[model samples]
Target: MSSRTQHSIIDLVSLEKEKINRLFSTADQLALNPFIPSKGFGKTGALLFFEASTRTRMSFETACAQIGVHPMLLDGKSGSSLEKGETLEDTVLNVAAMKPAFVVIRSGDDLDFNDITTKLQMPVINAGWGKKGHPTQALLDAYTIRKHLGKIEGQKVLIVGDARHSRVAASHVELAAKLNYEVAFCGPEGFLPERFDVKVFKNFSEGLAWATVAMALRVQLERHVTKYSLANYRKNFGFTVENLKGLSDKALIMHPGPINQGTEMDTEVLQKDSRCRVLDQVSNGVLIRQAILLEVLGGL
Candidate 1:
C-alpha cells in the first residue's frame, strides 16, 4: 500500500475546489480507460450501511473490485452488534480495530464525522447521512453535468420535487455555492424546505424554461408524516414529456433514483427522452466512486 497520509470524505464543504477538480479529472481518466493498474491489491475496506440502498452501496463495492480491494460488507441493521444495542460510534470503532484501509458508511441519521474521524486511523467516506447530505452523489451529479454540458459553473440547475426530504438536493445546494452554479427548488409548497436561500419556483413550466439542467427528485413518501395524494402530486409536479416541453432541447434532465415512475416523471421521459442523463449518472457514479476510493486510499 502507498505510504501517503489518510484522508476522509465526509462532505463537499470539507473539500477544496482544486481537490474537487482533481477528482473530476481522475474520473475523466478512468472513464477513458477503466483498466488502470491496481494499487490496492490485498487491501480491505468496510461498508457499513445503516440505511437501505441500491446504487451507492453497489457502486462502492464495484469500485473496490476494480481497484483490487476486498470489500467487507457489514450488516448494520440485523447481523451486526448494532442489532444488539451497540452504538454507531462503537460499532465503527470495533470495525476499525480490524484495521481496514477505510470505511464507507450510509447512516440513517445525520452523523458528525469530526469525532469519529479523530478516533480512527483509517479514512471514513460518507455514502449518505440522513437528509443532510450525500457527498458522493453530489460529486457524480456534478461530474455528469460537466461531462454533458462541457462545464458546470454558471449553469442554472433547477431541482424539482421533494427538497425537504432529499439529501441529494441538500448536497446539490451546498455544491452550487461552492462550484458557482445557480440552483433553485420547485415542488408543492409542503414538499419544499421551510427555509432556504435559493430561488423557489411555483410554476414547474417556468422552472423548466429557466433551467440549463432540470433535476427531478423522488417524492419521499416514506419520510412523509401526514398523508397526501400521489395522484395530486403527479398532476401538479410530475415531469411528463408534455409538461417538459418548456425545457430547452439542449438542457439536460437528471434524477437520483429509485424514481417513483409516474409520480416523479413519466415513464416516457425517463426512457424516451434523449436529453435525460439518468443512465449517464449511474455509469459516471462508478468512475467517480473509483476516483474517490483512490483519493482516500492514497492511490492517486
Candidate 2:
C-alpha cells in the first residue's frame, strides 16, 4: 500500500460505514477459519504500549503471529529509552527507522497522532488513547454485538459506569450513530461525562431495562483524583443478579475487562450468567485485530 492509502486506524468517526462493514466482513471470514494461511510472512510490526493493557496487547500480538508477522512489544513496565525520558514521538520515530510494516500504540495520554503519522512511513493503529478513544476496541465491540445479536442497527447499548474516563465508551459513542445503534450512558454524576448529546440514566435499572446490551466499565481508580467507595459503587451500580433482574431477557452483558468482581459486577454474574458475552468479546477481539492488521498492513 502506498503511504497515502495506508491510513491510520485512529478515529472510527472518520471511517465510512462501507469501510467499517468491510472490516466486519473480514473479521467474519477470520472467525470462520482462524487457521487461514498467513498473508504477512516476513513482515514486522511494532506494539508500543505506554499504558497498561491485557486483551488489546495480547490479542494484537496473537493476531500478528497468526498472520506470520513478527511483533516487537515495547511496554511501559520494561526498560527502554522511554524510561530515560525519551519522548513518545521520538520513540515512534526510532521504531519507524527500523522499517516496521505497522505500529500499534496504546498511550495513557490522549495524543494527536496526525503529527506522528505525517512523519512516519508506516501505518499506525491506535490501540487506546487515554480517555479520548479506542477505535480498535470499538470495532471489536461492534463485531461482537453483530455476532451475538445478528446485526448492529436498531440495537440499544447501555454503557454503565465510568464514562467520564473511558476511552471505550468514547469510541462507542462516536461509532454508535454510524452503526445505527442507540447508545446511552448510565453511571453516577461524577463518573458521567460533562457533556453528551445521548440519553443519560441516573438510575441503572432504567438503563438496563431499556438496553439490548449492558456493557460495564471499570472505575479507573488509577486515573481518578477523588477517592471513591467501592462498596457504594457496587451497591448502586454493580451488575448483581438482583440488579440484573431489571435487564431484559434478551439483553447481553459485556465488559471491556479486566472485571472487578465485586465492584463493576458480581463474580456470579460474570461466571454463571449465560447471557454474559465477556469471553466471546475477548475471543472476537483476536479476529477483529487480525482483520485490522491485515487491512493496515495491506495483507488482505
Candidate 3:
C-alpha cells in the first residue's frame, strides 16, 4: 500500500524498522569511506530537481560520482523541455528512454510523484516533494542523529521553527515516530502543524529542557503566504546566543540549512557553539544518499 517496500523512497513511513537500521548500518560504513571503488560502474542515475537546492543536489551528484554511477542532472529552469510547456510526464518519458538505472526527482508540485511508480520504467526516489516530505533528507538526518547521540530510539528531539510548511519537519516527524524517538514541535503559532500529536511548546526554554536534540528548521519564506517578521520570530522562538549558552551540556544543536543566520539562530551560535552539528548533517547527507543509490542500483 505504501511506497516503503518499493524500490524508491517516497515516504519514510513506508520504511520498516529493520530497513531503517540496515540503511543506517550501510550509511555508517559508507561514511567511513565515502570515495568507494565503483560499486556502480555501468549504472547511471537521473536527478531532476524542479526547485532551488544547494545541499541536496550537490550531495546527490557527489554520491553518484563517488559510487561510480554516472549522474545525469536536469535543472527545470533552464533549457529543459518544461520551459517549452512540455508535460512533466513527457519529460519523464524522455528521460526514461535514456535508460537510467534510477531517477531522483524534486518537484515544486508536491503531488507530482504520487503515481510515479507506474509512470516510469526505473525506480523513482522522491528527492523532495513540496510540503509533503523529503524522505532522503529525513533519512540522512536520522543517520546523523544516530551517529551523534549513539542511538535514535527514546531520544527527545525538539523540532523548532516553521514546522507547518517544512517538508524536512514533516519527514523527520514521521521518521522519528517510526524509529521510536520522541519528537516535539516549537514554533510561532501560525507556523506549527495542526495534525501533529506531540507536545507543542510556547517557550524555547521549556523545549530545550525537554530535548536532547534541538533541531531548528529554516523558515519557509518561499511557501509562506502571509508577511513574516524575522525580528519577532527571533525574539519569541529563535535559538539566540543566550539560549545556546544556557543549553544543557549533553544537548546537541542542529539545523537543516541554508540557515537564516540571525533569524532562526544567532550567527554566533554557529561559530562559538561546540555542539552544533549542522556541518555533520551536510557530510552525512552524501553518505546516506550513496547508500540509497547503491540500494536501488544493486551495489552495496
lDDT of each: 0.87, 0.87, 0.83
- What's the CA error at residue 134 for candidate 3, in Å? 0.5
**Sorted on TM-score, highest at the top, how do the candidates line up?**
2, 1, 3
lDDT of 2 by residue, 22-134 (tens): 88998889988865665577889999998888999999999988888999999884699977888888898998899988889889664567667777888888999977899
Better of 1 and 2 by TM-score: 2
Give per-residue CA lDDT, model 3, range 1-300, as digits (tens). Answer: 433227778788877777777778888888788776655776888998888789999999998998888989997658887888887767877888898888888886634686866777777888889889999998888888888889888888899998888888889888987998888899888888987777898888888888988989898887778878989988877888777555677878998799998999888888778888889999999988888887776556
- Candidate 1, residues 105-194: lDDT per residue as tens digits? 888674566667777888888899887789999999999999999999999999998899888988888888889999999998878887
Which residue pairs show backbone clashes in model 3? none
Give model 1's TM-score versus the native structure.
Answer: 0.95
TM-score of each: 0.95, 0.96, 0.94
Ordered list by lDDT, greatest first: 2, 1, 3
Clashing pairs in 1: none
